[model samples]
Target: MHILHLPPEVISITCQGLEYRDLVRLRATCRALTGPATDAIRVKAWTVPMYSDCVMYKVRAIGEEEPIFQGYSFKKHFQHHFPQWLEGNLVEVQLLMSLAQEDKEDGLLALKQLTSKLENTHVHVKVVGDYSVDKNEFKQLVEIVATSPPNMTFGIKIYMNGAIGDFFIPDKVTRLCICYCRSIGDFPQFSPTSRCQVHLEIRGGDTDQVLDLFHNACQNSRNLSLAKVTVTVIPLTDPLMSRLETLEFDSVMLVGCLRSTPIPPTKGITCKSMKKLVASNFEEFSYFTSPSLRRVSFVFTDRWSREGNFIGLQRLKKALERCPSLTKVKIQAREHHLGSAETGDYWSDFFNCFEHLEDLEVVIIYSESPITGDCLDTDIIFLGKALPRLHTFCAIDDFGNSYVL
Candidate 1:
């Protein structure tokens, strides 16, 4: 009789002898065989047996849809970044090989020692790499992470060239960053089971691809960061944006702006729960209003406009007007020279909007003809009265001159 004709239990036991790749091939042969092959692969699977750019393995029992975490190399060089971790033999050989491929012995010894250390200590772990691991070592490392004690944090960053298959995303890992990897195939999405904070970063996918993974984070994620990702549009009203305490956008272009203009707390989907927001540049600001927002920062480049004639500044001002709960705000404007017309009580009025403001910092690239100190001094007087709750306020120009009130 063929394998498919065997009893399910017998088929599962037989398939268990096959390696992960072979089982995947076997599972593809027939629809009926997928059940047994999947069980065999799940119950006893391991990472690829060779050292490669990326590795994949299963993290849960057979038949259950557990996430596959794909470990890859990060493009950036971070060899000397973790001197302390390096000194203690906490670095894996595969990760080190990612940095220095010539040192094969060092990589092997490092992997062995790092796996030993993690298995014994179960401490907070961070794995950074550009290299791949052989099957045995990868299996041991996964085991350490799987059995890690509660309260331990785990972070892994993988940078690789092409698509990663069967990526194994472990549960409860605090931070999982995949940089420059191609695609995340079907697996348990990066949704952690516990209340543990999860941070995910995906890079180099189709610009128009909607990140359905974020939807899984609606109720659990504490923060979300997007960099250089081109998505058609992620609605501000998305549940993923609703529950987040902090949202950061870096080099991300949204097809639609969040709440084109501020909407009343009643008519719109207010991110009233978000506490902090950050934008890499003016364009990244989605203008999502949160009645409970306490902190915001925007770094404006010279592209916005020249010197004192800044439309970005005006837009930022308007955005700030809507956040009544803002307590701390920081704005960095490059190549910004405040013309006489842009000066005066205008700033005082701008500062007046944040009634609960506590800390304000403004850094501008002053032009040769910068605003006069006298004018800034006068604005300070008005600001002091309008913002009674202000404690620390400082404005620094590109020339290193500062006025603090």
Candidate 2:
């Protein structure tokens, strides 16, 4: 069989399955195969790494004006060229650049050029870096993105630099994520009328500043449906309590006023929209009075300061009594014996607090002496029958074993 007699379409299709590096070799085989193989090469260019390490390749058409690279070289090599085989359909355009101080000029220029190209097309931009962009650069970037159509989704990860204030929030962004930022003051304002759905995770900050930011943002937001809001707070506030749909507070200490304010019978500040809540300190549990709440997760750490114990189990019991709509509840107790015969009585009393709960997940980390088998069995039986609405029961040991409930 003379392979040379094969149709061009047949040859091109056959080469489609070859790896990118191997395709280059096949293209060099003969002039006849080169044309089809070149087309194949273009087709594979779409899958090339768009965002890697700290470098972002700002791509554009071949004849378009060349982007200024400053001192850095912009290789005009064919390897970086757009493949002709691509159907000219614009999908997502990702721009990556190292935020190194030396690379600042080139990075800014690349950003400018990329923004200009994006102005004419419906391409989503994902900017990933740890460096701090100046206020002027960040403002320009935000203006370009905000003015774009609302359908475009933009993702940006600016590493922890005290400079988050420089980046102004773009109004049209549909989804946003901020990680490892130094403070929440740099976060954008969320208006109730704003169309964006936000996911914010603040890993580091002074607790008061974090809570202040959360309260301010929630108050300004017209629609309170955030995808999720997770923060570590030293103290919790009532204002930040009412707005979130899904809330996670870790390493929080129940400080300030603990006087049991009678939970308003009408359901305090109805977070009819809340679906999930995770609190590490029971003293801070007073904030979960939403009638629309679906899930509640409690984590009791052994590392709790003296202030945490001051809030006491009584306050926690009253807080749970008010959450009538809670469907799932998870309790993670650390450094607390929750299954001793004495603790069994405490468990029986505590389980009675969540009368309306349907699904229960409990993790007890015993200290010193291991949990006795009889004590564990007694607590499991008490919880299973105590909550009449309960359907699924999970009792995890210190090692994360699920004992039958």
Candidate 3:
């Protein structure tokens, strides 16, 4: 059958794989194809952000592998999709935009229109822009987002890659992430009534200042996550560390850190309120303990090397024993050769550590490479004998296949 003989729905489905240029080409081919081409052009786009190059914006629609739309100011390119764009069925949307360059004003104007009625939907707006110059415009955007009915879980996150000028964090700001800030200058006034989660990526020069900022944020943010932040010594002795209920650190450099010192006299750094931890350098964290800790996840890019050099494993085992409330654990490793099961059931014995706990989950993920070990010292075996209350256990095999243990 000729292509045009097919129904319009079939033609629309075929257009999904075609690029915008291809769609335009299809539209130019004949008048009959125009309707279908336009329909395909509107593929699943609920919100249109007037895109710019001086800054990048990512409106991450949930479950989408690629962006819904990219390039061209929304006013120019997406006007055709406005009818589809006006669909009030928007359930969840995430819009990320950078306001660094000259085009910010135009982009913000377009964005304000796109987000006007988004108060009823689950909205998360990520602003990677300068706040000082467009202070009023920035606050207006937050006001639009924060006015959501009490049923919605709305969030506004500001990303700072440079210095913070004279500014104040709106009480509506939920999560604030600052990266490599040179000088904080006039510290932003945070409302004592509001709580905001903070993530800081610090540089070697700004280490002391950022650490102080981290501690100050603890009053409002009980959940703190740090990435690539340097510390000459563990600040466990600092009273603020104890107030943290959720602490996450991602530092690949801690694997071979030489300045590692005993965490004071307690044999390990202890957080009375810490309930969950996610760290990349498990070796350095062996000396960390929490009585209320319930879940811990370890992701490493290092190899186990040999059975004799399991200092990280030994220390973590002791640390796990100290946490009487630990119930769920996840270990994800990549590019690391955890050696074969030549020695014993040491890998299986690692699960034995949880034998004392009730209701537990153990997840072990390994790199599926020749150098990487496929099994955990023992071939896949149900850990039911070791963990009677094993809630969920997932592990990979020799072929990198995952199966329940």
Candidate 4:
């Protein structure tokens, strides 16, 4: 049978099975079938690049006025499949755009249209633009997105040089990430019902007030991360800490109150429901005790005093004593610290604490001092015996080779 004799629907299905390059060849074969063949190729090309409902907008390295994806015929196909995809999948759509040199209006317009079509779809807008943008112009864009749909679920993330003002986030937004945004005095407030998973890398802000805001608006949040913030004092009874299931802190300071006016510790902050925690400092883990914790990770650094006061993983040793349900543990320690003779005692103590750990991973970053073969073998054997439920043990050698034992 001649290919041209096939019905349009049959042709469409057949073309869908062809590779992108093959479809390109099919387009040139016959002028009569070019349109249908090209449409099928467009659908696959567009959907292939959408990673988890994300539309990555790319621009030329040199002089280019428009995004590479602009004026493409894939929008129609995207809208057709979006509803079906969202039926079972989470309604989280991300629009990542390059705003480094061009106007941000186009990206915002695309975000608005996408949210408009998928009612109540949670949108996460990420823009790579000039951090030093005009405040007034940026504010206008912010208002448009914030007020687009009265009941829309949306989140706006931008790297701005200046401090953020009182901008509204749609109550239904589930995640918000803002890096290098300075909010010195006043930070944006969320709705009472907002439970957004916040990841803020703030530069200049009264972090104590920021923590205070979390208690007020983000009471329902389960996952929270704060990076590069000067945390003055973290009370054991903060409402936000009580409900968290996953918490992460990187380069966060904990300046305990002065000796005269110290807040009475309420037997350390207890999160009976927490399952995972990743932190750079080990001392912070002491305050959090999760009976249901399954996974925990820590980044060990040289500046123990600057990060936290824990001598040779003592706090981590104590912290693990509480997480009886832990199943996985990851420790990334500086090479010098782990290779020293004194750490041998600590490792023995640390390994003795795990009982239900199934997956264990360790990365000892090598510098002037590297871990020896004997050290690695001993640790692996110790781990295998200590963890009866252990099934996988992984470690990275000095040559960056990952070995599974």
Return the top candidate by TM-score: 3
- Quote each prediction's TM-score: 0.47, 0.43, 0.52, 0.50
lDDT of 1 by residue, 191-259 (tens): 435333333333334312224554444444444333223323334444433433244432222343333
User: Which of candidates 2 and 4 is the stronger one according to TM-score?
Assistant: 4
Q: Taking the tens digit of each residue's C-alpha lDDT, what string does model 2 give over 1-405? A: 543579877777767767554554454344355554455342211111222212323433333222211122235433343333332323444544434456555655655554454454444445545323553545555665666554455655443344445344555555565443445445566556665555555555543465455556767775533565565432233443343433532112222222322343233334455566666554445454566666676655433223224233555556766776666666665565243444444444444555445443332232232333435566656666766655555555555444555
Off by over 4 Å in 1: 1-123, 128-151, 159-164, 178-184, 187-196, 202-210, 213-272, 301-314, 336-372, 375-389
| Descending-TM-score candidate ranking | 3, 4, 1, 2
**How much lDDT does candidate 3 score?**
0.49
> Relative to the unseen true structure, what is the C-alpha lDDT of residue 274 in candidate 1, on a scale of 0 to 100?
60
**Worst 10 contiguous positions by lDDT, candidate 4:** 42-51
lDDT of 4 by residue, 1-405 (tens): 977899988888888787555564455345467445464332211111232233433211113222223332445432324334222223344455444325455555565566566565444554444333235555654565556664344444544444545655555545555544344444455666666656554443444455566555445333333422333343434443443324443223334321212464445665555566655444455556766666666554434322233355454455676777776667665643343454445443434445334333332222222333435456667777766656666655455544455
Native-structure RMSD, model 1 = 20.9
Superposed by TM-score, candidate 1 places the C-alpha of residue 242 at a distance from the truth, in angstroms, of 12
C-alpha lDDT score of every prediction, in listed order: 0.45, 0.47, 0.49, 0.47
Weakest lDDT window of 10 consecutive positions for candidate 2: 44-53
Q: What is the C-alpha RMSD of each candidate to the true structure, in Å?
A: 20.9, 13.7, 10.7, 11.6
Cα displacement (Å) at residue 389, model 1 = 5.0
